[model samples]
Target: MIFPPDLVIFDCDGVLVDSEPLTNVVIRDNLAQHGLDLSIDRIVDLFVGGTIMGVQESALEMGADLPEDWVDNIYSEIFEVLADRVEAVPGIIGVLDALDAAGVAYAVGSNGPHRKMEITLSRTGLLERLQGRIFSREDVANPKPAPDVYLKAAREAGVAPSRCVVIEDSVSGARAGKAAGMVCFGFVAETDPARLEPICDSLFADMTALPKLMGLPQ
Candidate 1:
């Protein structure tokens, strides 16, 4: 609600690290193995902001013959690929630098599990900077679209929800931020604008543009 919010909370997968495309490909291939052939775009639409457990539930409902160990197995595969190839979202480091220069605090709040983030963020070289500031679904009873994760991040940051701004890349994450009573900026570089335009306080397509959007000096 104000220039230079007290805290900035970022979603991990699509917002901080560019892991969605890689993860989606893995999901699509695995789903096909189970007889549910979905496109990468469809995978993103259904699972981007949700957890792997949610994906299992949805995939089952959609006729995928997922086994009992599917979630664990898929995660192992995802973690393997992420550890080898994940990279930070372009300009994210610059954005963080600007926030640092402006003296605004930032943290990561994600629907992803800790182990997954450990692999992806580490691979992207963001884990060290985010070390203790990362809040994941494992830290809360409910994940995104429920507000628990974002609320936890703000609470732990010692900032009021009103003074926090969430950077999200999906409908579920945006909804969670709003439910947590925070202003949310949607990163639409990899997402469809129409999906987030109605939910976000603002929208940005480039990570380099985020510092200005957040009222940070260049």
Candidate 2:
């Protein structure tokens, strides 16, 4: 089936940028400093595509008495490492160019904090392509799986929810896009495609297939 979406929404960490492994590494390293260490898979399962506060809350629930300032410290460490290592996902630029050439408007809707989002996009050279079109979880009362971010993104992009398509790599993000009434296409990068397939309207094995899948004048 052809999906003629007016606006294409992208998730940042695992979708647009290849930063999920880095993020999990940073989180694990920082937490280890405080005597709290988590496996990367656990981190990915629990924190990927979740808000900062939500992750902190989860950490607390997991028995870590992280102070209010812990989030700040984690951010600082993550950004310090990210500033030097973050890069765009392979094929992202090509996909973006294809979308632009097709005149399909797109925006980023992420559950990450504003600073992290800014730094990742800027350091990876994606900021210019996404300027004025980035929407963070902070922009809404709730994050992914709540649909607020995607709903707001669609509105800001001047497209109705049904006319928008969301590209995501996490279950939370895909769920949010579906809840927002948009077609959700899962981009399986580091995860198993079968795991993401059921929740996603369609699954793209790589970014190279996105334009065609979205019916973007390919």
Q: Which has the greatest lDDT?
A: 1
Going through the candidates in order, what is the number of backbone clashes in each? 0, 0
Q: Scored by Cα lDDT, where does model 2 land? A: 0.85
Query: Candidate 1, residues 95-182: lDDT per residue as tens digits?
Result: 9888888999999999998998999888888889899999999999998899999999899989999999999999999999999999
Best-performing candidate as measured by TM-score: 1
| lDDT accuracy of residue 192 in candidate 2 | 73
Report every candidate's CA lDDT: 0.93, 0.85
Stretches of candidate 1 exceeding 4 Å from the true structure: none
Q: Each prediction's TM-score against the native?
A: 0.98, 0.95
Question: Residue 54 of candidate 1: its Cα lDDT?
Answer: 94
Q: What are the runs in model 2 whose C-alpha is more than 4 Å off?
A: none
